[model samples]
Target: MSARISNNLRSAKAVAAALSDSEDERLSENSNDGSVFLVSNDEDSEIEKVKGEDVITEYEDDDEFDLETEPASKQRRLNKGADRQSCRGSRSSGNPNFSTNTKNDDMDVETPVEAFRVLFDDAILDKIIIHTNEEIERVMCLLISKEHQCQSIHKKIDKEELCAYLGLCFYSAYFKENESCVKDMWDDVFGRGIYRATLSGKRFEFLNRVLRFDDKNTRSERRATDKLAPIREIWDIFIQNCTNNFEPANNCTIDEQHKPEIIMSYNCYKGATDTFGEKSHEFSTARRTARWPLRFFYNMLDQSAVNARVAYNLNADNPRLSRKKFLKKLAFGLVEPHLRRRLGIATIRASIKKIIRKLLEIDEHVPAVVSVIKENTRSKCHLCDSNAVGRTRMKCPNCLRRMCDDHRTAICVECSAAN
Candidate 1:
């Protein structure tokens, strides 16, 4: 989602800082779980100033803002060593020395469902199956009622029936516009008993409430200005998970990838508008608004499928494999190399923790590395190769002094020009 969002917007840097900041929050959340950062063997890891963002936010409106896995065995040991070396190198020399791999590593590719199934127990999965069944049946009933001009009788939707129904919907998507809607799918063709259970929207709502793992009192406290002392516990967990995933970013290169804002905002704006309202910022608002809803939850589950594959690939027998190169190759191949989402940083972090912890709970046998790195190192400037800032550093819109300072409080050329 983040990758897609970046494609829509003209400026990707706009959210880089947002991501960086939330990275800390997410990392901190995992401190106790041994899932994010490997507890530093060294007591002092030097904190560098924030740097590398191309441009600061142009949003004068203050509303812009924001927001892991593990692997295993022989490969995991290498990552741990690499992580320790990277950290110590950063502290002593103020530079990043991170993952360096050859080209022969094995690749683990997942078929979506295989990876996601680890996160849910039979009970949770059953609940999902049940809810999905209800959802499909409800839509079918509505369609039937409208067509027949009478109150359609509700029916019980089972897993096999839903699967048959979905198989058609999946194929139907290629139709002129879309053939996935429940109404469009109800026929004698897909399967005879697939949708025997169809209920009206009202009836479904009455039978089962919205599925949520968080407390009813749970809500974001970030909007508060007065150094809000209390925030939800879930948010903490989410941040730690993110830090774990984001930890490997020892240095960020200033590659001239297409205009992130233009690419992402234009393409993803419609999605954000569709998901939230047009009024929300494409990444920030849309992501926060969606949070751990079933759709996002599904996406998180889907992401695990990819990560598990990556972990497997890393652990593959090829000792000569290059992890970074392998990831880049995989990026172009069948699976996504990163957990890219275009939502607010915080919300996305929460979604990750949700997926990871659930998996950890259900599949305790799964290694923590599948969802997060052993630890993260500070990012160094691609040019200077110096230890860079901790979170996000600003680039001058005026002068070229882009490597050393915090511009969050001070005004930039936009303000200077006005003066």
Candidate 2:
């Protein structure tokens, strides 16, 4: 506010601008609020007062003083084609300062929506649609016959609409997989309010019947053991076909860019990605819960990822697919011919008596050993110290006392209750 104070500040700045080039190289940079600062070389008294430290004014100054800061009265001549010799830079005009460019050419410029659209190539989508409709019909018959209540429920899903529904489910769930339920996914796909309209179909029906398989005809001893036989076949076809089509990177290493399945470190460096910050929780959350009823979700989550990869990989495989024009006859193209070996079951279990006898023999008529707790070795009983009997075989944990097998009880109430 005052001329004298302002003069002092300017004098300090001039001195700092002078001394900045000579400080310890490894020391932290002089910075304030992220802006680079400099050291002051004001008069010894002023420097000490301003910085609250001893001022070592005897050290030599550096050439960077004038190289960086110039006095207002004495203007610096710009780097015009030099007339005199200098060591700081090449004086020739041909040696123009070449600043580095910040933009990356490798980054994908496609929008998420556009990238997503590329995944559902028309033919693969058609195959998916047909496969889906067939599943719906087959499931519908089972529901109607076994569940008489299904007589009241009726719906027909065509290929086009079913495909769209599946796409929407993926689009919504991919973004919010960790935090939201399937219903939340639907709400996101449709819109966010009581007044919002959505696709006209049965939500309950879709959830219950989507990709479910039920078969009761087989009575073989060993069949591929589970429900969802038909759906699993479809899933296998999709994974196999997509895997066959993919081309891995020429020089890309898995542990570098792609995360490893075998976890060696929890705290380790992860590579950069565009969505790294926003979707940051995915990796940590994935690591935290690696088991449980997440089997359904584990597959779905992978599908969401592979959907993106399918887009990117196909892009890299041939730029033509990514750019414009069509891929040659895209199709689900599932060939459903599979061979299986059937094992026979014995039909000679004529009486329940023989079955019971076989089960008892298998068990050897002994109840299983539920648990065993070992004890420390000891030479004598804690109670009687009897050498006449076998050496002490166990110890009392609480009191650190030894006991022979003759004196050993299954559990000592006193010792068991103690801490």
Candidate 3:
């Protein structure tokens, strides 16, 4: 009985398959002919039979189509579906495309020196909150520009050349800008992330090089004036603002793990139990002569100590020397070998002597003004050293120096004479 039923069903399936093909051809012919389409009962009966056979056929295939035994085409389709779904989710969630490279085509080629000037013009520069941004960009531009000119003569710019350009550029412009704002942004520019290419592994190693420019301030300037504290304070503010406030949507996540301290202690004092001391080399002398500002010296030493300790912990085989020895070593390392390699120590020393002489002259000239101004300006004008100072009066139309009500022609007597 079952054999008879199976034979009958197979014959019915064959008849249904033939009718399905006939119907498909008729539908296509009618579609092209644009005639009145008709679904007769005979065609409907044939369609129902075909659909029943298709269901049976799908069941048979599903039984044979074990996922483990599925063909590569099926697997590929499955994977493609999953990938599409994941991409949809990523797009919906605002996933950052971190893989996009930051370097532009112009960055690799001969970058125009004016590229920096364009980047730092008032429109872009005014948006920067960090104080060091403008100065750093300026110096970077100057160094790169100067090096570009030098390299044009030779036809190349290498990594060392780039670094030396940075060093010279930064050092040259260090004292020319407003010191207060410069000091405030010290950490963000020099202490953290990758500014130019300084390594933070050495504690305040980079910052110490930076603060060298400001070390010449007279004793009075060293005191906390109304303006701002020394360079270290500037760095602290930068670090605080950057870590706590700035919203970095793209870069690496910086957290407490990275900033282990408010400021790293460069030199440690073994003898003292004080919170700030850890017996560093600069401690004794700095305390004795009071040559450097105590706060600035402490900050420098602390940063150095922190870096030295980190280096020691990392087992970095960097040359370890006493405080005085390290300065000499760093100074020696600072001299550019490509340009001055042939120069002898005597020539270098002579250059150093000239720099020292110039520095001393500045020191003498600055103090003379300070003393004279102190005597006369008890509350007097900085230019004329006269008590001719007042508020709510027009400035000297010529000199623009503020003058007393009596002097509001405010023809600064000094400017009047100059004309």
| TM-score per candidate, chains pooled | 0.25, 0.31, 0.20
lDDT of 1 by residue, 1-419 (tens): 33333232323344543445465433231333332212223434322223322222332111121111223344545664565555545534633333322232222224322222223224444554655445545556676778854232234544433322222222222121121334333433552121212222233232223334333332244325422212223233433443343324333222223343343223222221222221111111111123335334433332333333334444445333333333223322221111122111343333343333342343323222211111233333233435544432434333423333333235333223223
Top-down lDDT ranking: 2, 1, 3
lDDT of 3 by residue, 1-419 (tens): 33443343344345444445465433221344342212233422221122222224322322221223458657756665565466545533655631122123232212112222222223322222233233344445677878743222222223333333333323322222212232332344443112112212221222233222222344247555623343444444434422332223342222222222211211111111222243333322121223244345434333333223322222224334444343323222332432232122243333333333342242312211111111223233334444544333334444555454454332333223223
Instruction: Give per-residue lDDT, candidate 2, residue 200.
Output: 24
User: Which is superior by lDDT, 2 or 3?
Assistant: 2
The CA-based lDDT of model 1 is what? 0.32
Q: Pick by lDDT: which candidate is best?
A: 2
lDDT of each: 0.32, 0.35, 0.32
State, as a TM-score between 0 and 1, how close model 2 is to the true structure: 0.31
What's the distance in Å from true for residue 400, model 1? 98
Residue 74 displacement in candidate 3 (angstroms): 91
Q: Judge candidate 1 at residue 240 and give its lDDT.
A: 47
